[model samples]
Structures are given as C-alpha cells and as structure tokens.
Target: MQNSKLLILSSVWVEPKSSAAGGRMLQLIKFFQSIGYSIVYASTASESEFAFDLNALGIESHVVQLNDSSFDGFVSEVQPNIVLFDRFMLEEQFGWRVVQNCPDAIRILDTEDLHCLRNARKGAYKKGVLFQNEMLFTDVAKREIASIFRCDLTLMISEFEMALLENLFKVDRGLLYYLPILIENETIGKFDRRLSFSQRKDFVFIGNFLHEPNWNCVQILKNEIWPELRKCLPDANMLIYGAYPSQKILQLHNPKERFFIKGRAESAEDVIENARVLLAPIRFGAGIKGKLLEAMVYGTPTVTTAIGAEAMYGNLPWNGFIADDNQAFVASAVVLYSEEEVWKNVQQNGFEMVKERFAEHSYLYDLQTKIGYLNANLKSHRQQNFIGMLLQHHTMQSTHYMSKWIEEKNKK
Candidate 1:
C-alpha cells in the first residue's frame, strides 16, 4: 500500500461544531491519515465560514464540478487507491464517473446514515401513522440500495441499519461494513472531570437546528413537553442549544418561561457537562444520536424518546430513561434533575455504555484488516460481487449518457 491515496468526495466541507455529520467526516479523515494514506477531500458544495481547514491538517482540498468531464480529469490525475463517497448522494452523482475513469480504485460509500429510513420515518411522523416496512421500498431506497450494490463496500454507522440492509434488502454482508463513531482514549478520563449533580442544573437539548428532526424536537418540547415539565418543576429551565438557528427557532425562545434558545453552543461538551440532565425528545430519526453519546461522555444523564435512544445502547440499560410519552418524558427529566442518587447511577450507566459500545478499539483493528484483505483481493472481490458489476454495466450506461448530455448543455 505504498504511496496510497484516499480521495473523499463530500457533499459539504467538514464543520465539526456545526453538526454531527461534520464531526463524523473529520473522524473518518483522521482515520485515513492514521493509516498513512495521503488524503484529498473534494466537494461540489461551497465552503462555509465554519468549515474545517483541510490544508491546515495537511490534507489537500479541491472544489470539483458536477456532471462535467473536469471531475474525470481530476480523478485520473489524483489516481487515488481508494475513492470514498461521503454519502450515497455523492455515490449516485459520481460513482459512474469514478468507475469509468479509475477502475482500479477501491470504491467505498460512507453512508452517513440511511437517508431512506430517515425520510420514511419523517413521512410517517408527518402523516401520524406507524412507519411500515413498505415505506423503505421507495425511490430513495432504490437509488440508495443500488449505490450500495454498485460500490465495493459501504460503511454503515448503525448496526440496526446494517441488519436492515442484509436481512430485508438482501444486500450481501461482504458489500457492507459497520463502522460506528470512534470515541477517543482521552474521553474516558474526562468522565471524572464532569460536574457533580449538585453543580449542574436544569435540562438541555442540543442538536443542529438545520436538521428537520431537531426543529421538530424543539417544537415538541415547547408545545408539548416543557409546559407539563414546568408544572412539575416550576423553577427548572430548559435550555435549547444548537447551530444555525433560524427566525422561526428564535421565536420559540421565551425568557420569562425559562425556555432559553442558546444558539450555537461554543462547546457541545461544555454545555452538556454543565447541565444536570439532557432532554432530547426526538420523535422519529435514524442512526445513533451524537448528542446522547456526548451526554454519556460528559456524565450528564439524559431523558430521550425511544427513537432518540434507538440502536444506541443495545441491550444494556439506558444512560437515563427512555420515554415516548410526553408526560413520562418530562417526569423522567424532572426526577433525573432532582434526585442525586438516581442521576449518578444513570451517569454511571452511560459511562459503561460508552466504554462497551462505542470505544475505537472495538472496531479499528478489524476495519484495517478488512481493508487490507479487500485491497489485496480486489479482482476476486469484484468477481464475487457479480451483481455489482452487472449493475455498474447497465446503470452507468443511462447515467453516463445523461451526464454527458448535461455537460454539453452547460457548454452551450
């Protein structure tokens, strides 16, 4: 693997503080760097004020174009050993181009989370209906699943989603890899440094407001949860924190009611650590919740919905309480805030869950071994994945022409 290069195609530049996706992207970049792979991050998306400076980290950054031959030239010149699509959308947009230009490069799709599952849940929530399995068989699923099959391997962040792919969709196990968020070794030691139950106060909800689910969660808290919680503990405050707060979100802030909208937390950890209880009533979403994970790391007990806690804690006891009922949710938060012994015990449960489920050591070595093996046996690997090759051949024929047509149209 000497002189190996890993080219990452992102839809957005990394902004760790802005969202969990940004933080996850940075983690993957660092992982590639640690394994001695020269990295280049290319994106069609424009850079933001808060975007992480790739150049500062000794990683090359490129702004590439869509539906253009310029990307073909870029990929050919870079000649990356590995081409990683940041999400399935990137895969759908550029997967064919990469296959056509760089046949030898290992194609991997880093599915941030299953977008179809998220969208399906969103639709169900909006309709006030139970999410059905048939919902997963939509247009989004077709594109996403096809992208999974087209790639050599797809990285899944959640085990639940991984099972859904194999058991329901019949995606080959070899074509999917489970790669959860890697917690740092130093993070465990920081658990001792967290504020005691007495030092911390109130309930806190932190998430990226741009996420539809988060905005929905904040609305639920304001309209449904908080009013009931306040009735129980009239003095307790519920601090709503997140990045990219719009006018609509800001309007929800009422200082008299102590429902503070503290936009853009300077440090998610700092805020979570200082808070007595983290309350995230995420109604419907996919993958693991990063805020809940951070709460565990910071020793802040959380009271979240079943959907918020989904696929995170496994069979282990939750860090705090999991309640879907608004009344139960608020009751759990009030108790978690008021009782020291219960809160401390819940905090310890979080610590154990973090150590057991999310530690880097659990996955890093296995990932390295799998990648090395896959790289060594590329020819045979592709041969075994005949369906992928067939899909690539046929799907690309249509996609290839459409892209070329778009390129020509743009030239005129």
Candidate 2:
C-alpha cells in the first residue's frame, strides 16, 4: 500500500513559540506524520523569522499565490488523499481549486476557533452591551458556516461551539468533529518538576499581542485588574509577555508601578512554569484558551474571566478561579497568590484536567478511524450532505469566476 499524501493549506507558517494556534497546527502536523502520511504544507502568507522550518521535518513547503491558476496545477501534481485547510479563510481561498483538481481527496477544515463567535463578542464588548446569540448572525458567520458546510468534516476546538453550530445554526452533526489541542504524555510528565508556589514570584500574562483579544486583555490588566491587585500585594509585580508588542503596549511598562512589559519569551513553558499565577482577564473571545492550557501543563494556576475559561475544564473544576468582575478578579488573584494550600490544590486540578481532556491517544485514534470511514464511504457521505453539495456547486461557480477575473486583472 502506498503512503497517503496529505496537503495542508495554511494561512501562515507555524510558529509554536509565538501563539497557541501555531502550537495546535504543529500538533496536527506531528499526528499526521505519525500515521505515516507524506505531508506538504502550502501558504500564501510571508514567512517570519519565527516560522517553523517545515523542510527540517522532511515536509515540502510551497509558497502559493491568491487567485492564481498555478495552484490548480500544483494540487493536481501533489494529488493528496487528504487536504486540510488550517482555518475557514484558507478553505474559502483554496477549497474550490482542490475540488476541481483532486475530487477524491478528503477535505477537512480545522477551525482554530469560531471567528464569528469571537467577532460578535468583541462587538458587544466594544459597544458596552451584553453579547447575545442573536449577535452571531453576521456576514462573517455566513461565510464561515458556508465553508464548514462545504467541507467533509470540521475540527472544532470547543465543545460549546459544536453545540452552538448544531442547535443554533442547525448544521448537521455529521459534519462537525471535536478535536481540542492535544498534549503528549511526555510533556504532561514534566508537571512534577515545575517550580513550587513559593519558588515562583510575580503574576504573568502572556499572549500574541497581534490577537485583538490579547491586547484588550492587557488593557484590562493594566487599567482595571492590576491596579487593585498591586494595591493588595504591594510587593508583587505584574509581568506582561507576548509577541509583536506595539508602541502603545510598550508605553505601559513602568518601573515605578512595578508593571513590566516583556516582549516575546523564547520559551513560553519556561516563562509560564516560573510564574506564581497566570492572569488572563479576557472580557470576550471564543474557543478553549491555549494560554490557560499551557499554564496547566507547567503547574501554574490561573485567574481568568468566564470568557477566558469558556469551554475549557469541561465538568472539571478550574485550575484556579474564574472571576468576571474586576474586584472579584483581583480578589481571586490575591487569594490564589497568598494561600499556599489553595494554590497547591488548584495546581493538581490543572494536572488532572490536562490528563483527562487533552491526552493525545484517544483523539488521534478517533481521527484515524474517521479518516478511514470517510475514505471508504466518501461517495455516500457526500450524497447524505445535500446542503454541502448545493453550497459547493454555488461556491464553485461564484468563487471560480471571481478568482479568474482577479487573475486577469493582476496581469493588466
């Protein structure tokens, strides 16, 4: 039997150290490689200094162009058995081309999170109104949902989002798959060696500042949470760390205030493991947070909002406290920071949560089974998805011609 070829169409090159999305993509890539698949990664986005070296892993990396017919020829050449779109936007850009070139290939969409949900919550937060499910009805939602319907299967990071799509949008359950970010058993074993609560000092907040929610979160930490928190614990410092820190973010750093803005940790695990408590006062966002999960792996308990803790922890207790109000958030951080016994207990909860929720064994096996089933019954699967077929037809006609026009315009 020939080794199956898998092509990944990514919006950006993976930079696992920079963001959770990058780490999640690396996890997926390693999983497919383990299953003995030959992988090819293609992206239109420019590579950064931090981008992962796919060539080092023996994976072919290609620089693809938008609205270019050359992708049609490239897809035909690779002729992969599976084509994974890194996100809905990637699916929208290259999905039609894949269908025309490799009709037999299984199409999978990995939704890092529901962009529509995040956008709606952000809109509500900006307007100072409570976010409602009704707010989810936007043009972005329409585009994202259409991309979901067009794919054979979609990997959802949040269980809450899976339920939302099925109940609210009435999307067929067969098209959605729950696959959160997975942690290897080897990484999970390092929890015992992490620094004890006493050995660690200061509260740390780390994220990719390019993400709007992270920037918003930092502002909340600076203006609302940190001010009260510092007053309570006069000696303790608030350390902010992330990638792509803008001038505005840099200006927030003040030695007199004991609030430091550190840019780009070379090792996120090292920074997180040494922190006494992780602070993420996320007012609005979607999906299970990568930062929270990383804190768990490193035995660093966190105090975050309900929005930050959403769809994480499942029925399990949070690693630390979940507080929405600024006062409550400050109080929780203080308590988690001061009480040694409470800190130790919550740290254990984090370890257990990681073992139960993110163990890679079950998810990887299930993924294999899903792909096998889809490979054998692909024709029947497509037949059962009438909405998908309809959308594919219309999307192909519209996107196809529009792309052709863009390609012609670029020449002129």
Candidate 3:
C-alpha cells in the first residue's frame, strides 16, 4: 500500500540549523516521514540559503507565487490527502484554493504564534503604553480568527493560547490541538557544577533581531535594565547575540556600556551553555520563549519577565528566576550570578525540565497517533466542521477571482 500524500504550505523556507520556525517545520516534516507520509512542501517565499533541502528528505518541493492562478492548478494536480499551512498568513492566502481543489483533504494551520496578540502588544509598545482591551478588536484578530475557522484544525504551540481560544474567543475545542515544542531526547548527564561555574561568564541574551519583541526587549535592557545591572554588578559584561541585527541595533553596542553585540552565535547551544545567566526583561511578548528553552537544554538558568516565562515551565518549576520589574530583574541577576549553589540548583532544574517535558520520548509517538487517527477519519472530521466548510466556500469564490485577475495582469 502507498503512503498517504501530505502537502505543506509554508510562509517561509524550512532550514533547521538557521531559525526557530524553520527548525520546527523541519522536525514536523521528519516526523511525518517517520510515520509513512509522502510529503509535498510548497512555499510562497523564494529560495534562500536557509531553505531546507527537500530533495534530501525525498519530499517534493515547489515555489508558489502569491495572487497567481498557477497555485490553483498546483493543488488540483497534486491532490494531497492532507494540507498543512505553516502559519496564519499562509492560510489566509492559499487556504481557499486548497479547499476548492482538494475538498477531501484535511486542512491544518500551524500558528507559530498568535499574531493578533503579538501585534496588539506591538501597538501598545509603539505608543509607549500598556495593551488595551480594544486592541483585541483590531483587524489582525479578525483575519487570525477567520483563518482558524477556515481550517479543520490548528496546531497551537502554547497552552496559554489554547485557553485564550477557549475562554476568551469561545473557539470550539474541537478546532484546536495542543502541540508543544518538539525536541529530540538527549539525556546526557548533568553538567558538572564546578566546571560550569568556572567556565561561565557575563550576562547573555540572544534572539532574532528581525522579531519585534526581541528588538523591543533588547532596547528595554539597554536603556533601563542593563544600566541598573551594571551599577550593581560592576565589571560584568552583557554580551548580546542575534541574527539580522539592524543598523539601529548596532548603534546600541558600546564597550563602556558593557553591552556588546557579539552578532549571531556560531552555535546557539555553545553561547547559551557558556553564559553565566540569560537575562531577558521583556515587558510584553507571546508564546514560549525559545531562548529560555535553549537555556534549559543547555543547563543554563536565566532571569526573565513573566511573559518570557509563560507556558514554558508547564507547572514544572522554572529552571531559573522570573522577574517583571527592572530593579527586581537586576537583583535576581546579581544573586544568581554570584551564588554558585543557587546557580547549580537552577541548572539541574533546567536539565530535568527539558528531559521530562521536551525530551522527545513521547513527542513522535503522540504526534503520529493523533495525526494518524485524524487521517483515518479525515472525511468525517471535515463534515463535522461546518465553519471550515463555509470559509472554504467563500474563499474559493473571492480569492479564486482575484488570483485570476492577477495572473492576467502579469501576462501584460
């Protein structure tokens, strides 16, 4: 018997070694392959160095152009049994066509993060203010919600978001599935505390500067948190690592400030494992913090804000300190840096948390079972989702016409 055909629509290229999202997507594909699925990965973005080698994975890859009729034919010819959208925006763009041509296929949306929440928080940050209730009613929410409605199911990474969809949005429980960050298990012996203490130095923070939240958090530290930290812990170095650092970010680097922009780390694990303590004083951000998770996997404890610590610990005791206020954040960093016993305990806590929650012992099996069960009953599942059907119907009518219009325009 032939394996099930699965088509993945992507917002960006998948390159595990390059980015958090790309790496996650690469894992998903591998998981699917492990479960006997023939994959077809498509993306609207053009190829880049970070793009995954789909050929090596034995998965068919295609470049898709937005607002073009060619995508309609692409789906018709491929006729996959399952279609996974990488993020909310990709769903909004290509969702209807998938429904139009491959109505029988199960449409799944992979929301990397709640864009609505992130955008709302960004708006609040831009105004130098707090998030307002009115922000939820903005356009992003509508598009995001509509995208969810259009899909058979959505893969939510954060448990906090799963609750928001249920309590706040009244989203149907059937429409959302909780799928936390997946990791490969490496139950390596805990790092030697003495060796860790002797090798560790400086306060470290790393994130992709392309993300608004990281840029904002770094600014907060430079202007507010780091200055105070330096006052208390004199002679301490605060080295920063991130990809796509802007000219604006470059301006913040200063030896006198004790804040050095070391650029992107050659290996995320190396920089994090070597750090004395990870420092993130985030005012507002959504989803699980990858830096903190990496810190945990690396046996490094961090001091971050409540938002940074959200949904990550999973009732497992945090591996390190969680502080919201600037002064408190500084104080925690100081204590954690100096007290070897305290630091050692947190490191052990981190290693244990990673092993228990994300050690990938059950990740593959659970994902395979749930996905296989859904696949077995895919038709009935779609029939039960009336909203998905309705959204698919209209998406076909409107987006289909607009795409034809663009294709015609392009010929001229």
Candidate 4:
C-alpha cells in the first residue's frame, strides 16, 4: 500500500537555493518519500546550481536532454506508475513521450501558473493596452490547452486560474483540482508593531524582477504612480526589493526621487515584515503572486491592483485594499502605509487568511490522499482519459518521428 515508485519529471532540478518550483517539488518529494513512495527525479537542467544534493535524499536522478531519442528509451526502462510534470512547459515537452511509452502511467501536470494567461497579460501591460480575448487564441493557447487535455489531471495552483480555465478554455472541472501552495502551519510570531512598522518608513514593493509583471509594476510605480503617492507622504520613501533584479531594473533607482531599488533581499521575510505596507500595482498576470502571499504570511498588508490581488482574497475581506486606477491605487497605498489602526486591522486580516487558506492541514492531507488513490488506480485512471490515449497514438507516430529526425540530424 505504501512504497509506490513515482517518477517526477521536473522543469529544473530541485534547487532550494535558487528556484521556487524546485523547492516546492522537493517538498512534494519529501512528503511522498516519507509515505514510502520511491522517487526518481529527472530534468534537463545541469547538475550544478542544484542546491539540494540528490544523493542525500536517496532519490534517483536522471539527466534528460531535450529533443533527444534517449528519453524514450530511458522512460521505457523505468516504467514508473505515476509521472509528475513540474510545469506545463515540461509537460508540453515530454508529456506525449510519457503517454506514448507508458500508456498506463498516470500523467499529472503541476501548472505552476497558466502560461497563456501570464503571457497575454504581460503582452498587454507592456503595450499599455488592455487584455483582449483574441490574443488568447495564439499558438501558446493551443499548446497549453493541448497539454492540459493530454494529461489525466493538472494541479491548479490559483483558484482564479481554476475558474479561468474552466470558463475560458472550457476545461473539464474533473481534470482540474485546487492545490494552492502547501505550507507547514508554521507560526508567524506576533508582529513587533514597535520596531517593524511604527518605526518603518515608506511603501515597499517586492517581487522577482525576472517575472514580466514585476518589472512592469516597477515602471508603473516610477513613471506614473509613485509621484502621486509621494505627494501625500512627501517625507516617506518607497523601497523596491526583489531577487534577480536586472541592470535595467537597477537603473530605475533614484535617490532624489526616493525610489530605492535595493536589489535582492537576504531574507524575503525580513524585508516585507519590516515594511509599513506592501504595494503591488500589478496590471495583469495569472495565478497568485508569491510576493503577495509572502506579504500575507509576514502580516504585511498590501495595496494591490485587481489582477495582483485576484483569486487570493476571494469573498473574504482583503487584507488591505485593491485599486486599479492610477489615482485610486496611490490613495489606497498612502492610507495603508500611514494609518496605524487601518494597518493593524489589515495585518491581522492577512494573518487569518494565510492560516485559513494555505495551512498544510487543510489542503495537503486531501491532496496526498488523492495522489495515493490515483497512483494506486493508475490503470483504471488512464482508461478514463481516452483523449490522452488518442493523443498518445498520434504523437508516437508524429512526435516520435520528428524527434528521431532531429536526433539523426545531430549526428551529422
């Protein structure tokens, strides 16, 4: 009943020091392995920069190169009962191969976020235009949805995306399951109201700058929003903190403007928890923003846009405020940052929300049970996904031949 062997094909190696997805995968691996499931992690990323030593965990590791025939052979040899694709991109790349070679294997796609939605929203924000449905019909949509349909099931990370997929793409509700960031119900000690916030100055914005939406938000704050906010709190500063900030992002730095770009944080938790208010005026993006979740966890209430706060607050009252228009967003940020009573209420609300939605006891237990059931019933589960089999039949003939052609070409 326990010791189920699982093969997890990741987009990158589980590098806790570098990757969020990698760290999440490691947690899942730990959970499964604890329950006696043997795990084999395979990825295309190089062995270096993989912070966690695979040998220590006793999980088998395989280095898979893209556009190669060797993968089919390797997968056929392993014959795992369940295959976990780290993200939709990985699923798009090797999903068909797994389905073709191991027809009975349960294919699970952990859609880190809806790529099509992210891509579309990014495109619109950069152009200073609004999102249009016609843009959704692009090639990414075809590939993204095809991967969703090809897999037996997909792990939906954001409730907003779950509804978007079902309503917009018409994906079967049965194929999508809610699986938010599963975190241990660790205590986020009482907010040190004296030093952390009362003494703190300025509005703070934090995110991974490599992400398009974050970079877009930086520009919005600098060119448009901050000037308005400073008018209200002229003595206050706005500190922008994030990881992997590019030179271009650093150039946004201006002492006179008081928009400080302090690069990557030594500790993400420390930066946000110490801030007076978290400001994320994200125009459009998909999935729940990790920074916002981190803010909530740190009890740092935020002032964000509709897109930034989407699906997270839900019917429950928001930790702080949601504003989209330029003037409204700036007004909300000033109020959240300066008003101690309002800030305290928002912070407490955030603490409750994280505890309610992301606590391990609520989502993880049920998810583990589902994963066990699916793994145990792999054969019958695949039978229900006839479209997966149909796709497998054709992809074996088409993609198999195409991969072979490329593999043969590489020899010359």
Instruction: Write the residue-wise lDDT of candidate 2 on 355-402 in tens digits.
Output: 999988769998888888998999999999999999999999999999
lDDT of 3 by residue, 254-297 (tens): 99888998877778887877888998887777777788887877
Off by over 4 Å in 3: 132-134, 187-195
lDDT of 1 by residue, 280-336 (tens): 999888988889998999999999988888888888999899999887888888889
- For all candidates, what are the clash counts? 0, 0, 0, 0
Q: What does the lDDT come to for candidate 3?
A: 0.81
Clashing pairs in 1: none
Give all candidates' CA lDDT scores.
0.90, 0.94, 0.81, 0.79
Q: Decide which is better by TM-score, 2 or 4.
A: 2
| Number of clashes found in candidate 4 | 0
Candidate with the larger TM-score of 2 and 3: 2
What does candidate 4's lDDT look like per residue over 142-241, in tens digits? 7788788888789887998888888888888877889776556545444344244576666788776667788889998999999888888888888998
Superposition error at 178 for model 4 (Å): 0.7
Model 2 lDDT, full chain set: 0.94
Instruction: Score residue 114 of candidate 2 by CA lDDT.
Output: 98
> Order of all candidates by TM-score, from best down to worst?
2, 1, 3, 4
Task: Supply the TM-score for candidate 3.
Answer: 0.93
TM-score of each: 0.98, 0.99, 0.93, 0.91
Estimate the TM-score for candidate 4.
Answer: 0.91
